[model samples]
Target: MPDTPPEFSESADSDAVAEDNEFDSLRGILADGVVGAAGGLVGTAMMTVVFLIAQSVGAFELTDFAILMELLGLSEVVPPVLFGFLLFLGGGMVPWPLLFASLKAYLPGESSPVSGAFFGAAMWSGFVLAFYTGQTGLSLVLYGILTLVAHVVYGIGLGAVFDYFETRPDSIV
Candidate 1:
């Protein structure tokens, strides 16, 4: 009151609040990215288990990397298996996770896991359409079933990770 007008003081206070809100928004974005990446790691690992089992049981021969290799035309230039796997892993950790985090709020489900499953299933449609493996008969059916199951497992794992982080006392988001 002595040094500054009331209006000026009010303006300063509002400015400070606005700055804090901006910071909080940025922080929330970072938190979502980090959490989503972590969830992706877990989700990818779970998906890999299903794939390995399915491969062993002769359900299908294609891995995530295999499809990626063909799609990217890297099979001839690089060691397809190793390079493709690395690419797949990197993709799982970043883009997919970020996308999942962005869409989580809008997805339908009673819980995080359920929502994640829906997300995975939705993603599956893309995979089936974009990366058709050309299987037929029993193998095709098994491939469809097994891949769907794998995706659901992946989503469950991802959502579980999100749930775990969200419930923590010092949760970022």
Candidate 2:
């Protein structure tokens, strides 16, 4: 057999597991491109998915949770769900502006404040949702404070994600 160079010669995908685990691959690309973007989508969707499922199973009604029991089902959930949907839309849009702004600072491109603001808002929304979920001691002060810090971090994730791709051109989502 021409002295067979090696039986276990490593191949490009030799270590790849034999499963249709595309989600991880996609997530890795997305995270590398935008950490929060990928993480946010997965996290938020997971929560909302569970919530929606619970609604069908009457999970909201089963607990002593006031928000679900006391508040208007149609009204309360709708606003927040809509609010979250808007945030996700904004989430998708947040990073590019910061990326371009970075371009303005170092590279050559138009920097957009609107994009930055959207990015900030999306990040803030994550924190706000967290506080909103707590029924015992939900307060505006907590929401406001957390929102401010999270927004800044969200913007950074955008820039970092974009930059990561710059260095790793071989990467793809």
Candidate 3:
């Protein structure tokens, strides 16, 4: 006996629900991407600090920035530290989070620290090993070890931050 048809009202309700669901899905994707990027930045920052400390203590004696500068033909134009910073931001901070977010499903241990550490090792194998193994000198071995440790630390930080943010719906909103 209502003025409105029952079919019209039912369809409207279903449409609203569908729209809400779509919005939620989009929001989730956005949250994941943003959180993952932030985590990567943090991890890279921590790695940088660790490397600096190692250098100061004479435990490590490699300059990846120097190598990078030479490779890019920027050795004459820019200092290694400056170039290194840019590389760290771009290479370590930007890509890692996105990579983690994309590969998280396939990574073992359900986003835990262990899984993150494993992911770090995977990254080392894929990126670090491929790039650094060809370099010459005793520093290479020391640098390689230091880089391995740093990458693992980075992974832990990346995973922890992502997981923390992922679990908190209110934080994303």
For this target, which candidate reaches the highest lDDT against the unseen true structure?
A: 1
lDDT of each residue in 32-142, candidate 3, tens digit only: 567777888878887777677656655454465666677778878888757856876677666777877678778888665667777887787754653463544656665
List candidate 3 segments past 4 Å from native: 1-31, 57-59, 126-142, 171-173
Highest TM-score against the true fold, candidate: 1
lDDT of 1 by residue, 61-119 (tens): 64546667877887888877778778876887888777877888999997889998998
- Give me the displacement of residue 40 in model 1, in angstroms: 0.3
lDDT of each: 0.79, 0.44, 0.70
Each candidate structure's TM-score, on Cα atoms with residue i matched to residue i, is 0.79, 0.32, 0.70
Off by over 4 Å in 1: 1-28, 62-64
Report how far off residue 133 is in candidate 1 (Å): 2.6
**Alpha-carbon lDDT of model 2:** 0.44
Which candidate do you rate higher for TM-score, 1 or 2?
1
